[model samples]
Target: AQSVSQHNHHVILSEAASLELGCNYSYGGTVNLFWYVQYPGQHLQLLLKYFSGDPLVKGIKGFEAEFIKSKFSFNLRKPSVQWSDTAEYFCAARSTGFQKLVFGTGTRLLVSP
Candidate 1:
């Protein structure tokens, strides 16, 4: 069975700091990658995705991720984060021809203002 893992369960940081969340998946074949973010009281939004083409993909809200096949990792990174960036981050994956998504537990980011 395939599963996703998020290394950080919760993270706290002051405003204007860098942020990085680790995501890993257990799958042998091709997969679709995604990073969805949920704001304080909002629904999930597609922060970024890696379907094909480049291994490095950039998404909205100044967030980006690198897809490393060898490591089975897709880590999200932001050089400078703001207080408004406080949200819960989830890493998800689906098989090449599958529509169902397997989501990581999630990483809650608390950015202090």
Candidate 2:
């Protein structure tokens, strides 16, 4: 069975620093990718997604991700980050023709003002 992997367990950055998180998956077929953020006590917020069309997906809050089919990776990146962007980011993958969502280990981002 294919699975998701997030090598970075935790990340720290300044309020105006850039943020880049790694997200990779192991699947042989076409797949849908997603990036979700969970604030301190809020529900899951979808940051961005890639279903088709352009390989690069622009998500909410100035975030974007690139889907590399050959690498099976959908890395999330933000040109600049703020204190409010501090949250737990999750990378998820769902193969085509399936309704299952496989999530990565999760990456915790900390931003200092």
Candidate 3:
């Protein structure tokens, strides 16, 4: 079985500041990595994902993540952030050929203007 771990529990930032959220999974086989976000009062939305080909996958609203297979890591990043970007981010992993998804607890980002 695979498990997801998100080191940061919460983060606070001002507008225009950079962002980076760490994520890691425990599985030796092929897997699909993802980042999901939930706004203050919205449904969970997919941010980015990596299943094959490129390790560095870009997501909506200037967000990106790198899949390092060897390290079992998929860290999310953004060059600059805005107050609207404040949300709860979750890291998820689904093993290849599997339908079940394992998600990290979540990292909350609070961006102030």
Candidate 4:
């Protein structure tokens, strides 16, 4: 079965610090990638997504992801993170012709003031 992996289980940073969360998928075929964020007590929200058009996709709240088909990677990046950015980040992938979306274990980010 295809799966997504987020290498960073937990990340801590001060406000205004740069952030980069790794996200890699195991599938080789064309896939739809997404980055979802869940705040402390809120439901998951779509942070960014790549469904083919451009490899680089800009998302909400200064978040962006790049889809490198050759590497099977869709890493999320933020130039400067804020305390409000503290949340659980999830990487998900759904191969073409598939109905299920495989999600990663998730990376918890705690940003301090």
Q: For candidate 4, lDDT tens digit of each residue in 7-107?
A: 99999999999999999999977899999999999999999989889899999999999998888899999999999999999999998878899999999
> How many residue pairs collide in each prediction?
0, 0, 0, 0
**Residue 11 displacement (Å), model 3:** 0.2
Candidate 2 per-residue lDDT over residues 55-96, each given as its tens digit: 988999899999988888899999989999999999999988
* Higher-ranked by lDDT: 2 or 4: 4
Give the CA lDDT, 0 to 100, for residue 28 in model 3.
68
Q: Mark the 10 consecutive residues where model 2 has the least summed lDDT.
A: 26-35
- Where model 2 places Cα greater than 4 Å from the true spot, the runs are none
Give the Cα error of residue 24 in candidate 3, in Å.
Answer: 0.4
lDDT of each: 0.96, 0.93, 0.95, 0.95
> How does each model score on TM-score?
0.97, 0.97, 0.97, 0.97
Q: Candidate 4: worst 10 consecutive residues by lDDT?
A: 64-73
| Candidate 1 lDDT tens digits, 28-62 | 79999999999988999999999988999999989
On the 0 to 100 scale, the lDDT of residue 65 in model 2 is 96
Q: What C-alpha lDDT does candidate 4 achieve relative to the native structure? A: 0.95
- Candidate 1 vs candidate 2: the lDDT winner is 1
Stretches > 4 Å off in candidate 3: none
* Global local distance difference test of model 1: 0.96
lDDT score of model 3?
0.95
